[model samples]
Target: MSVRIDITGLTAERIHFAPSPLAEMGAALHALAEPAHHPGVQGWTTSVSACLDPCLADRMCEADFLWRTTFSDVFTPSAGLPGLHTLPGATLGEELDLLDKLSDEQFVDAALEFTCQSEYARRDVARLDDPRARERALELAAARGSHQVRFTQRLLEDPPAIRAWFRELMQDCDEAFFSDVWGRVRHQLVADARLKTDLLRRKGVADALSAVSGSVSLDDSGRSVVVDKISVGHTETGSGSLVLIPTSLGRPHLWVLHRKDWQPLITYPISSPGLTAPTSVEQLTLRMSALAHPVRMRLCRHLARGSYTTGELADAHGMTAPEISRHLSVLKKAGLITTRRHGRYAQHQLDLSVVSRLGGDFIEGVLR
Candidate 1:
């Protein structure tokens, strides 16, 4: 499933880049909720989580029912938020104030809209008033579990309580750990946004979008930005603008929020800061060293045609099984080969993409 945004009438002026502290807070909460999705930040997540109040952590766990695909959409400053003008990017206080100001009815409506969108791809305002639609949405929410269904029911039944609960969660989160997390990552986020702006100026929107993530690309018409997502929908950017946000905590996932009547937004992963010339050179050197051995080079040539077991490779290369195993371990660690087990046999094969990228990777490293 994917979301296609038509950029036919959009321009450089229509595109903006910024970092949102509220958004980062939501992402941090999400990482705490689903640690498996963010293996890169496990240490950070654990350290921060350990510092939280036990009661507050329990409250956060209770709130996980709202995380259908990610941190609850209701908690995020989506495009539909009444006055979430992210052009300048709001401070955490500013965004929380915006949330605090939403009237009971408005907050309820937003919660319902997010609920409907999580189950169905569309977020029709009319669905809020449709009793049948609400029931059906609740029914689909059941697939996630009774806990989520009950959570949505409570949200619909007691908007004021849910709103207050959500608000307190954010406030406590800021006090507990997210404030410091933001302080630590704010500079990196700003640097990424600036880098994106420069890329947009030099290469145009498509390339800039590509820089955001490999999952973003243009359709054949060159008028739409296709984002790979689990839910499918289409949005036309008639006169609406687009906002691109950079986040250090939102690693390994790209999130897109689109609405027919508001500006669309995308939160993409921050590029690795460790992608320095030294690191690149080290990787190239490692892969080269792995293949530098005569036996290893011969193994690569043989594996290129097809996979072979350790015993087969040893016999073919006039070596012992242990010798072939040691050489395979080196190739595997360098990411030049892959091993898969089939019953009692483990087959080794060359990874063609890594092999083919060797020259380009070396040149890119040197230039960097």
Candidate 2:
């Protein structure tokens, strides 16, 4: 299953490429929370962990819900989250200032949306429209985990207090380590945004969507964007726009935020020296070398038509299964193909986006 974005009538103006400090901050926090998920930044993570204040680290650990689930919806482009909804601030401090100025009414509505984790709870909260309903929602959320009980309670009783509390946590996080990390990666993020924007302007919507992430693909009709995600859902950007927010911290994870009366926002990873530059000189060489083989080139051409299993590819190429598997492994290592399981069989398909970016990557790598 995949998340399909229906872009049947979206114009170039309706598609936006926003480089956001707020998004990067959120991504950095997520990486901090789950360092194991981002293996490439282990060195940076180690240094930052050493620099992090003990109390700040403890507080972040306590707010596991914020990073683990939908509780951080306040930071997303939800109609309830005012001043921060799809607004790409120039700096994290600017975003924090907007968060600091959040009105009581706005905080209550946004916190309410986040606190009600389930549709049934949200419906009851809306239907009842009472303090008790809000309390019930908090209790349900608290019952799910002990970590966020006090925070959700504060959300129910004193919205401003909870807001201030999280604001302080965010501030401490910024002061402790994220600011340094942001300074290091900000330029690369902007460059990636500029690259995608250029692709959008020059190549139109299909290529533009393809440039978002390796997992994102535009269907043949050019009306739908197929995103490879664990959770299966369909979102249609009817009159709303599609907002692309680039982050340098959260590699290999694409986060989507869609809410009523707000544009659909996707926070995708674009780490420096990877998306913005070559991972290594060896990567360019590997990609070139993988396709240089005549058999592998023909294999890629066959897979371009459709996906195939090892035996099927062997049969088509008149090679043994072992030989074809070896060839496929080289292509896979170079990020030229993706393998997916179909029942008991593993089927491989060409990753067109990665292949398409090779020429540009080569040019940038060579010039640099």
| Stretches of model 2 off by over 4 angstroms after superposition | 69-71, 77-86, 100-116, 119-124, 271-368
lDDT of each: 0.73, 0.70
Residue 255, candidate 2: Cα error in Å is: 0.6
Specify the poorest-scoring 10-residue window by lDDT in model 1. 274-283
Residue 208 local lDDT, model 2: 77
Segments in model 1 whose C-alpha atoms lie over 4 Å from true places: 81-88, 100-119, 124-128, 137-150, 229-231, 273-349, 352-368
TM-score of 1: 0.69
lDDT of 1 at 172: 87
> Can you write out model 1's per-residue Cα lDDT over 227-309, one digit (the tens) per residue?
76545667766666678888887766677766445457788778886532222344577798998899899999999999999
Native-to-model Cα distance after best TM-score fit, residue 56 in candidate 1, in Å: 0.6
Report the Cα lDDT for residue 217, model 2.
Answer: 72
Instruction: Write out the backbone clash pairs for model 2.
Output: none
